[model samples]
Target: MTTVPTSAPQRATAPPSEGGHRRRRSRRTRERPNWVAGLTSVVWLAIVIVPIYWIVITSFKTQSNYYAENPFAPPGEPTIANYRLVIESDFPQYFLNSVIATIGAVIPAVLVSFMAAYAIVRGRRSRLLRWTNSLFLMGLAIPLQATVIPIYLIIIQLGLYDTLLALILPSIAFAIPLSVLVLSNFIRDVPKELFDSMRIDGATERGMLWRLAFPLTRPAVVTVTVYNALQIWNGFLLPLILTQSPDKRTLPLALWSFQGQYSINVPAVLASVVLTTLPILILYVVGRRQLLSGLTVGFGK
Candidate 1:
């Protein structure tokens, strides 16, 4: 009877699977939809796209149709008469002026900014360089609008007033700070070993600049050029104050004049806008990738 009193065997139970439970929870959280952010993005996208749609559609419509039809509707019968009118109304002259000012200012500004940035990064130990960099940064802190009166005085004194040079000079000043700031940081991102190796191989400072640094940071250079070109192209106040002659007027000035003259012809004004926007849009499309890379140089890299 005592020998028959054996205890029953117990079944081995599995331990709690905490990791799998946690993973399931994480999956659920990851898969969860963000309604608020999605909704906000859609709202903002519409806000931007709606105006662009209206402008493009309106540009193709006749003035009578523009006023008579729904503002956002596609043209019933699109016409190029508005474009022809804008082109014939001295658009090419203003466009050429913009091209000249943009090219003149951007080239020098980029070259100077590139060298200045290289100096600032490569000569960090030099007190003079430090001071110069500080001065350039200080320039950025001062708003361009605030300096309009002083810039006007300087342009007038230099006899650059009523000339494309008037636009070019001030644009160079404004463009340099941001270009240098972006470029110096981009240069700083270059591997120190590569620089040292280049130096060891008998490369001089100038050699290293053009051969090594320039190639690596060329994206950034393109970025600044496109960005500055865009800014100078669209600049209004500078052209308004700096030049008085219609012959020296840039695209922004041309657009303003379009508004004044075609106040009643809404489609014609929009047509002029579309034509004026084409170059900038093309420039942007060409350099968009390089521009993005250049502008975002040191961030999260």
Candidate 2:
């Protein structure tokens, strides 16, 4: 019997209509941009940028036109006289003072905070470490206003009053707690295996910190540094109370002086404000990527 060659059963295929339905379903499920979120972002951007726009425009206007006309109006004839005045005045000295104080404060604050945070995170558990951490956190709770009088008296007793050192020291002390908190969180995210490996290789605690932790924690370091820099640079009350001499003044204090007891030079004052903001703006522009990365990395973990 020549039997018909047995053939393998064919698997059934889905109809073309079924495939098309899946594609259509996927297309329908695609996400759309959120219009409400976009609108809110635009509104926030305008709120931030409008003042900057007004400041820049006011900086270019003549003193008389600055006050007489609407602030939002475009300049009829832009001039650099305000900047020129700022440059020729004690503004440069105050700017230099601010730069010095910011740098001095940031360096020590970053270094000390890093070490303290590393110790807190990695050292043996003890009441001392706990107490220290609590104290650091407490620093955040004590407003600068409450301590201003005590700080002033202390500065005078130390003969640091009227000196940039007075401003630098206090700012560092005030900034340390927040810096420690940020750095400690970042440091804690570092892998335990790395530390163990370093130890197995005979790395000292200091060596491990410098080699393993510092490089890993750079983003947090930059964030803390920038934060401290901004605080010291823009600080007013401490400088105002500590330093009495105009030559010893900081940018914020100098800006305050631009407004006389009897009259104010709004244009000159705004120009000074613009100048005062430039260094910080430049810093943010340059370090924004690091700052953002650090924030995300520190917070995400």
Computed on alpha carbons, the lDDT of every model, listed in order, comes to 0.92, 0.89
Per-residue alpha-carbon lDDT of candidate 2 for residues 1-301, written as tens digits (9 for 90 to 100): 6889889999998677978989887887666667888999999999999999998898899978877888899889888888888788877899899999999899999999999999999999999999999999999899999999999999989999889999999999999999999999989999999999989999999999999999999989999999888888889899888999988999888887776621455667778889999999999999999899997873554
Q: Which pairs clash in model 1? A: none
Screening candidate 2 with a backbone cut-off below 3 angstroms (N, C-alpha, C), the clashing residue pairs are: none
Please give each candidate's TM-score.
0.91, 0.88
Instruction: Provide the global lDDT of candidate 2 against the true structure.
Output: 0.89
Top candidate when judged by lDDT against the true structure: 1
What is the clash count for each candidate, in the order shown? 0, 0
Q: What is the C-alpha RMSD of each candidate to the true structure, in Å?
A: 3.3, 3.4
Query: What does candidate 2 score on TM?
Result: 0.88
Q: Please write out the lDDT profile of model 1 over residues 97-147, one tens digit for every residue.
A: 999999999999999999999999986588899899998999889998899
Q: Which candidate is the best by TM-score?
A: 1
